[model samples]
Target: MPGQVTLELDPSLFGEREKRVAHSGKLVATAFRYKSGVAGLRVDNGAGTVTLLPFQGQQVWDAVFFGRSLTMKSMFDEPQPTRDYLRTYGALFLHCGGTSMGNPGPTDTHPLHGELPNLPHTDAQLVFGEDEAGAYLDLTGIARDAKAFHHDFVSRPRVRIREGATSLDMAVDVENRAGKPLPFLYLAHINFRPVDGAVLIDSVRDDRADATVRQPHLAQDEDEAVVAYHRAIAADPSSHRTLKAGVPIQPELVQTMKAAGAADGWTHALQRHPNGSGDFVSWRPDDLPYAVRWLTRGPDQDALGLVLPATAAPDGLAAATANRQIVWVAPGAAYRTSFRFGALDPAAANGLEATIKTIRGG
Candidate 1:
């Protein structure tokens, strides 16, 4: 009833077909190839194509639809992270920040983002099977993050793309391997490129959370040529208040989800893609209550990234802990969460309201 709402879709054609996965020039199988230190795998599940980077933080480097990329890659020409670590950017990857994404908050000793991007997955697997969808393919990997005396954690990611479908799903499981309760942060650092003239539209189910706008106007900062544009958006008033972006609220009654676990309830958002379609990413609100938008619309770099995290703001470990926004994993325990990425045809309907109703189904 507020703002300009526009969305469209065809639910009936959301057809049921057997999915598939394969390697380059081959069907019903998978393989790994490398160029220098970079390694990647080609995945085609009948409908779309995905290139998975096994060595580059175990992320999907490309998700292609209709012979075009629906995902964004950083403008940093180089495909992999450099020796400097922080310069390692781009590709629709995971955890640009890390288990501790964001700025070196209060007790940060690592670089910006985190070490996850450069940390290679020591173990992995590729498998194909026939499920309810008839046929499917997925790649699973296990990576560990253990500091000498800090925190020891494990990440298990399984990426799945269905055959004849315009979508991909990533299911990640994180475990605290330390003896004492350890703090944790997780984000699906999704980046999209060529967003120079892209129109972005997102909705808040509750109310608009205070969004901390970065220096969006500055193409470059005094220190270094500004490399990116980003925004930290809260899912609820509680977390927004902690950023001092707004007034205070009853701490207990409010859903400071970033601080707590996403035990129940969920949140969703849709964006009119720069490629004439729509890209939608949704997650359990209790798991990733905060959303961050990184736009690379600068003179130096050109791209856009949407980071939905289990915690609020990739500011740092200290700020998250202080705001009670950290996802605390009990000693020797684990947690699991997932997010969905799919494309829709906004032109299916005549106008925005019809589009929204068609996709959401009224």
Candidate 2:
């Protein structure tokens, strides 16, 4: 069996350096806790470091590639308790939904973005292994959402990063333990900070007809200026490809896109920064048929959510049901999806851009 260690929260170990460095060409994982008592795990893969918050929905809290930060900016300074979702919502990768996601309907009782964000895991472990591909570190956790006589399900989420790599691979296997079939909604809320002059690239059609702007209900009371921005997006979805540093995407701009998959059945989304560097994510379109573009460029928070893969748009449970967009999982059945988030240097970015152009037939 591969070596494994159970995660524990220890404030005394906070900010301690990783004595077992990855200099030997092996992946390293260190567990620590923040001053707020939130548990975290840091994994070093020689080329980059990723912080995982096991106690807080197993979110990828922060990621740094070769001293460059690839995460979004937020008001929160550190991670907070699971109940304080919004207060500690500045993670690089956040897993949303499982049972229910998005804003709740007027009479609905579920919390915002479902019960996954900041939801504590029942148990988590760090497993070290060497495969044909390379040495890798795996962070696995089990979380559950249940209600009496209603629905019960377990989500097993795993995040893996290999040695000498700047990418993280994520997969979630959700099992329905309820007595009957259950409806499911899922979204990978990946938040990548925008770089000035970065151009957005994705596998979605660039035509306005292939996109639909769905204004978030929470932003309905915005001022006229923000409302006009939404109108601009509706009129020309292609405008979303250009990113500026100081623009305002207050509340957010939610656009549902008609995505196309490559010959290998994977969809690609990337932000090619002006310096020739970039951040990208790739996922299987078959598993997540719906692609959403979420951008929030407020004063305090600036994020370019390149591509959000989901079983359905974040239109609340009621709307999804009415539209028959929710995915149904049979009792004792499981649903699985995987994606990769990586940083690219100039050369790699150039090569990827070429490939994307070829795929787009440009």
Candidate 3:
């Protein structure tokens, strides 16, 4: 049997339980009050606590072990399109760059640096049974909204626990419930902040064969930034500079990366500090063909809080769909992408080889 746990949201425990989840315990689950009928789930894994608000399972907001530290600056739980929308749809964007309607991307980010459709919208159910079979949350309703009017949206999700494992699964479904067919965009904007003193660890999965980098808009200039970024990367083949600091990928480069892998797809990985106490961010693309790699640097940016976001489509939803960049679905379509947030124990450091073998289960 898995660990037995109970769920509820009691404000009195706010300081005691919620605060401790991020820095003390192995894990804890509690549902906090957000708005009408919408409950936010907070889980602590000692190193940090994660808050997941499942309004109809559309996941309006997600803040990890560090409390709402980052979201407080930009990712607030306001209405989608506007804070007031919360009264109408029970959904909100929580961030500056999310939408309420459309075929939200299957994952987040593309190599070409484009955007996906909207997040999932559907009628989902919450489960509170036992074990894997007892695990709750059925996103079937969201998966079945491909052909109908495509309007009303809801998200139902589940939190599963095992030793040293934390996983979040959710489904977004929208029912037209209106007269006309609904066309929208979806993207998972998963943002995480690295520990205060960590540096970016480059991996083989993020290699660029051509002299051309995938995106350039993120750069200070289109023509000059592209040339300099590529040149810096090329000159530093020995060191890790696949993406030069303080430069953004251009839009055209994003387009090129989209076309190259839209048919097949790719994977991106990052490693946290070798001796640190956190997990790396990983995402997989299911429906969208493209993946974008974004790096933010400046006096304004943090030395530790980096971003590795994934988008299903490139550009905005309108452009992705018009350019046939967005993947379409028949009636009753559903998509899912899974991520593992793993932490290394101090003992695992002493027995690095043994830990590796155990992770491999050999």
Top candidate (TM-score): 2
Per-residue alpha-carbon lDDT of model 1 for 1-362, expressed as tens digits? 12211211111211233223234222243344443345556676676667776545677777777666866544454456453444655566565444566667546776766666566776666655445654455677778888877888887777766666666777887788889877777767766543333344433333343344433232333323222101223223312221121111111011222211222454444455445566556566566777665544434444455335445676776787678877778977887877776565656212432333333332
lDDT ranking of the models: 2, 1, 3
TM-score of each: 0.71, 0.91, 0.51
lDDT scores in order: 0.54, 0.80, 0.35
Per-candidate clashes, comma-separated: 12, 0, 65
Task: Give candidate 1 regions above 4 Å deviation.
Answer: 1-34, 81-85, 96-99, 194-197, 205-209, 215-264, 273-276, 347-362
- Residue-level lDDT tens digits of model 2 in 1-362: 54433444333444534333222355667766677778777787888889988767889999999688889999877788866557787889989987788767776677788877777787776666677778777788788888898789998998988888888999999899998998899999899988888998876656576677875554556777677776677677787688866567778888877677788887788899998899998888799888888888877888778888888878788878888888899999998999988799989888877777766663
Off by over 4 Å in 3: 1-28, 31-40, 44-48, 56-186, 195-206, 210-268, 274-278, 285-289, 298-311, 342-362
Each candidate: RMSD:
11.9, 2.9, 9.0
The local lDDT score (0 to 100) that residue 300 gets in candidate 1 is 46
Per-residue accuracy of model 3 over 275-361 as CA lDDT, tens digit each: 544333333444323433333333333222122223333254555555654333333443334433333344432343333233323
